[model samples]
Target: MKRIESIKNPKVKEWRKLHKRKDRDLTGTFFIEGFHLVEEGLKDKEMVNEIIITEEVSIPQHWKLDGINLTFVTTEIMKVISETETPQGIAAVCKQKLAVHPLNWSKTLMIDAIQDPGNLGTLIRTADAAGIDGVLLGDGTVDVYNGKTIRASQGSIFHIPIMKGAIGKWLPSFSERKVPVYGTALEGGEPFNKIKSSKDFALIVGNEGSGVQQDLLKNTAANLYIPIYGEAESLNVAIAAGILLYHLRE
Candidate 1:
């Protein structure tokens, strides 16, 4: 395996750039740190372009790296590229493989302008666990590849299909198919439990502060709200999504 020791190495600079959204977009790849995420990315070997591990770190014996590009770096270089307080001694640069179409989607979670990276990641993880067919990120939402988002997903990012675009563009298609799309809001929404469970549907959760976009809510089959039963005024976007996702899939 090739070894890199200099923090100023040209290749190290390129890897650092992967931390930025624009750079990731330009290169069509993102950086993931920690063994769990690296292993998850390996599940789709074609998408994993390179693997970087510190010289002191050992790969699991069962990991097949036959055709993969493997690189060893010094501990110092690992710290420079790592986003966490405690580096896991391993990281991988993987290509972005976003789902291109909405075909065969029975259940999906549509995120509208959610700005928190942690919230976005947790939502993706929850959707994956709830067996949602896919996730659609709407305009103004945080990048799915953000470091915090990737870590929060606990490697679920690789297990599910995710697409990003204007949420409105997909509404008409769902409308034509008569699939129910539910939006969460504080007003004009029925109790979430009132809606019958279904095998196919879409749920839209919005920005933490503003909730779902008004125009988008108007387009949904129904608007829903998890009733506030206690003194608490609201729920975290991620927690709210988990409750609704499992209920809808019941």
Candidate 2:
């Protein structure tokens, strides 16, 4: 394995750049840290460009590294590249596996302008767990490759198909296919359970505070809202998404 000890090394500078969304987009790669994420990235080894570990840490014996590039760095260098409070001693640079075409699946979750990285990640993880066919991230949503988002996903980001684009552009395609698209809102909306679940449908969950955009909701087959029984005003967007996704899938 090649060893890098200087923070100023050109390769180290490139790895550090992966932390920024612009740089990640420019290079077509993102940085992921920790053992679980690294293992998940390795499942599709072709997407993994390189793995970096502190000199003291050993690669797991069972991990197949036949064609993978490995690098050893000093503890100080690992700290410079890590996003966590305490470095995990291992990290990897990975190519983004974004879906290029519209999803043709039974169930889909569409996110509209969700700005929180953690919430975005949790939504992706939940969608994967609920067996949703794919996740469509609308314009104004946080970047899926954000470190907090990736960490919050707990590796599910690697398990599902994710696409990014304007939510409006995809609506017509869903309409053309006769797939019912439902939006979440408290007003002018039906209770979620009242809507008949189907084998094929799309659900749109919106911003943390505003709910789905009015124009977008107008385009949905019907708008839905989970009934609130308590004094609490509303549900966190991620929790609401989990409830609706599982229900719609059933």
Candidate 3:
């Protein structure tokens, strides 16, 4: 194990930069905080570049960290790299796990312009629970590795392949492949239950305030809407995603 007692250490400075998306992209690595997240990263050894912990934290007995480098820093120093109010005393620097959709994917979730990290995380976790093959984060979607996004995912971030790309470009590929693409809409969409569910299909969920873009929705095989029974005008984007995903799975 290595010790980093100074907050001004050059390596510590670099790790702190990961809080910004540009830095994470440039370095090809991101930080995962908390015991569960770090544990999840450790499951795939190649994904974890280094494990960091405050001097107060002991390595979990179940973790196999033989080849992994461990760094111990003062609690204050850990705070420098942490994004939460109370730091969990553990974190890991993980390489980005690059993944892509296979040619024969069954269920896919396409997220478009979802700005809220929490909402995006919830949708990813929901998609994982519903057995989604993969998730595509569209042009304007929040960063999947954002601290809030990762925490919101509850470790599901490591359980699935999430690729970032423009929905417009991918929609055409799905069309070429004959995969049914469905878009969610605010109005005038076929009631979701009325549509026949399928094991192989792509569902596009839109931004919170603005539903799917008019142009992209045009490319879908059909548009779908959850029938609002009472007076609730709409559902939270994450809730809507869960409802649609499980129904489509059935």
- List per-candidate RMSD values in Å: 0.8, 1.0, 1.3
lDDT of each: 0.93, 0.92, 0.88
Give the alpha carbon lDDT tens digit for every residue of 50-75 in model 2: 99999788889988887889999999
- Tens digits of per-residue lDDT, candidate 3, 106-201, equal 789999999999999899899989999899888898899898899999988899888888888878778887889999996668988887888689
The lDDT-based order of candidates, best leading, equals 1, 2, 3
Best by TM-score: 1
Local accuracy of candidate 1 as per-residue lDDT tens digits, 136-207: 999999999999999999999999999998999999888777779999987999999999999889999999
Arranged by TM-score with the best first, the candidates are 1, 2, 3
Q: What is the lDDT of residue 215 in candidate 2?
A: 95
Model 3: CA > 4 A from native:
none
C-alpha TM-scores of all predictions: 0.98, 0.97, 0.96
